[model samples]
Target chain A: MPTQPTDQGPLTSQFAGDADMLELLDMFVSELGARSEQMRDLLASRRMDDLRTVAHQLKGAAGGYGYPMLSQAAGVLESQLAAPVRDLGEVAHAVAELQSICDRAIRGHRPAA
Target chain B: MSQGTSTHVRIDAANLESTRPLVLAIDDSPDVVRLLQVRLKSEAVEFASASSGLEGIELARRLRPAVILLDIEMPGTDGFEILRMLKESPDTVQTPVIMLSGLSSAHDKVTAFDLGAADYVTKPFDIAELRVRVRAAIRTFTLFQMLAQRAQIDGLTGLWNRSHFDRRLVEEVSRHARHASPLALAMLDVDRFKHVNDSFGHPAGDAVLAGVGSLLRKIVRDSDVPCRYGGEEFALLMPDTTPEDAAAVCERVRQMLEQVTWPRHPEHNVTISIGIAGAAKATQLAPEAWVERADRNLYAAKSGGRNRVVWTSIESPLQLNRAG
Candidate 1:
């Protein structure tokens, strides 16, 4: 079982001893990866509106799933995409950081016996 | 850490997905296209081929490939003419082109290089050498893009730093002025952030900043711009959002932050005070005026026992007001 931070929301504690935490984390990671790919495609196509939409979804989902780091990175990326023409490097960096966090979380959240 | 042979370049696997080198191959010879395609087939590359210079130009315009392999010996429109056309077209000029030719003469190579060909590869080229050059070109282009991205990003939080915020502000304000769209600015400050640093150290402060950053991202729409204005202070520019709407978003962020559990220091609760200002006809007012109004309201929140959202509007004569 994963140790839940006592100060966090009830959901965090509910998933602590449950066997479902691993599955939830895996689902979150897969979703983030897919969303990241979609954002990258939108950005490369110069479709700022689509990119912003995908990034905004990622930001919201990551936050709701308790992956605050990924959410923060996605938020920054979402804002950049919202601009008339986003600085590509800024978006890339934010995406890179988001990927890192998602990867780390996926690695850390292992199912308990 | 060896001299010129250093393989210090970190290949991020995630970026390699859509960021794979997009190569545009322009040659009249199908054989040459197949040969080059075979040589460049790697995990990090995608190839788009055009049999004529005109076709290449069209593909280049549409696909915006990262690099172009142009055969200088094409019949109707030779590589030089194509190069000229490519350079003339603003859309394709920035796309790097590599000249492919049977002409090994120094003069031909020099002319091709002078005509803005990134490099010249002689016909019957070493397949290995061609692969190396293609990789090098892609690597250089990617590096240039990374440098461009770094310039606009906030080094700390990786947010769209202040300069980008300023540019977006000017543009949004101009659009609002033209369309009379409502625009709101929310200036957020972490309540007692210095104390977080003092008690838990800078790492914990960083954690809080990261937390706040994520929280703000959650409550805003995709069209809104959230920026790290400066140390412990962030700003959000909400285009087409009314003051009431922006306040609702900021208030949600405030509540979210208040709920975040600080790692290793659960007792040290975090809170944010937001100052929101909006203009229905913001184009009439300068960008700084809107920001200043939001900042003043933020100050009001801080003075009035923090952890609340304060808002003001161009329509409201009331200096600035706070709500719990």
Candidate 2:
């Protein structure tokens, strides 16, 4: 656990306390690095649609996985991508911020049980 | 209500389906389905998943899962369209559907409910909350199942009642007519049932009837429908069974009953006479006429000898075989 709750913590799943969910949470954490890489690839290729799809999925999935901040970050990115007026700078900033959280989650993670 | 209701959900599990209810989750994301399977594992339910709308709907029809978890957005036909099709099909209409969506707007919720969804849960779900909702939906679905089925059952023997037999006879006849498939109808009567009642009292007579019901229930094929035709008489409608096959089954019932020794009157043996009428293609006569044919055969069985089976198939004249 870290001092800050949402943005600066050990990124432990809220479900870590649930004995039945430990394995599912562990599998999700193990897959985090690949998900991050997929995001990077989609962004690098300028496949905004595919990247937005990924963001939408994460927006739904992250909170369920007990990372509410990651869910919120991906949700913001998804909303920004949906906007008709393109804000390239804001979109890039959101992507970068989401990537950093993913980094923190991958680095600080310890599997429950 | 006259005890024609079947409280069979908790029956000895031999004569009815008692397996855990199935929960089907339809979502494009494998992770969401995987998460659901892990979260909802329990004694009361089993879990299955489909990745697309079409697969989900097809599975829904085939498995008749107790509950369906539908995702609103996907690559192919969306959840709303799938829900519409499910509602349209009678096979899946009664199953409880819970919509899973990323969109939580009141408009979306209202639309799902309008389309006959029992509940809606927005993603990122509180897993615990989803579990509770799923259980509630299963409760509703199974209750509906029991209420719909119990109406057709006979309370005394746990077999279908007379009215149900009549209705299903017509339905089966029409269905067989359409398909040009074989169907068999058998009329059975307890031989000297009145003698048992006169000597052993009404309770023993009732016990004999109950024992015959269990024997019929145990011996018949799954596709067969055995019913109490009223007092000392029973009927069985066998879909897709030929006259020869039907006679074989009837002979077994006759022989079995002839061998049963009443517990109170150990020396007394109960017997039944059965007459079966069948056709590969449905006979052109009304179902009542068909019943009369079987009744005539039952008369032959009783006159020829008690504890015997008589049968006739369409494309052949009235036939009689004396068998134990």
Pairs in clash, predicted candidate 2? none
- What digit string (tens of lDDT, one per residue) describes model 2 on residues B93-143? 999999999889999999999999999999989887998999999999889
Candidate 1's DockQ: 0.01
Global Cα lDDT for candidate 1 = 0.73
Point out where model 1 deviates above 4 Å.
A1-113, B1-20, B26-44, B49-64, B71-95, B101-117, B123-129, B147-152, B164-185, B195-204, B217-225, B237-245, B263-266, B277-297, B300-305, B310-322
State the lDDT of candidate 2 residue by residue for A1-113, as single tens digits.
12234455556667778777778777877877788778777787878877887888778788887788889999998988889985777777778778888877777667774
Q: Which candidate gets the maximum DockQ versus the true structure?
A: 2
- Tell how far residue B300 is off in model 1, in angstroms: 4.9
Candidate 2 is scored at a TM of 0.78
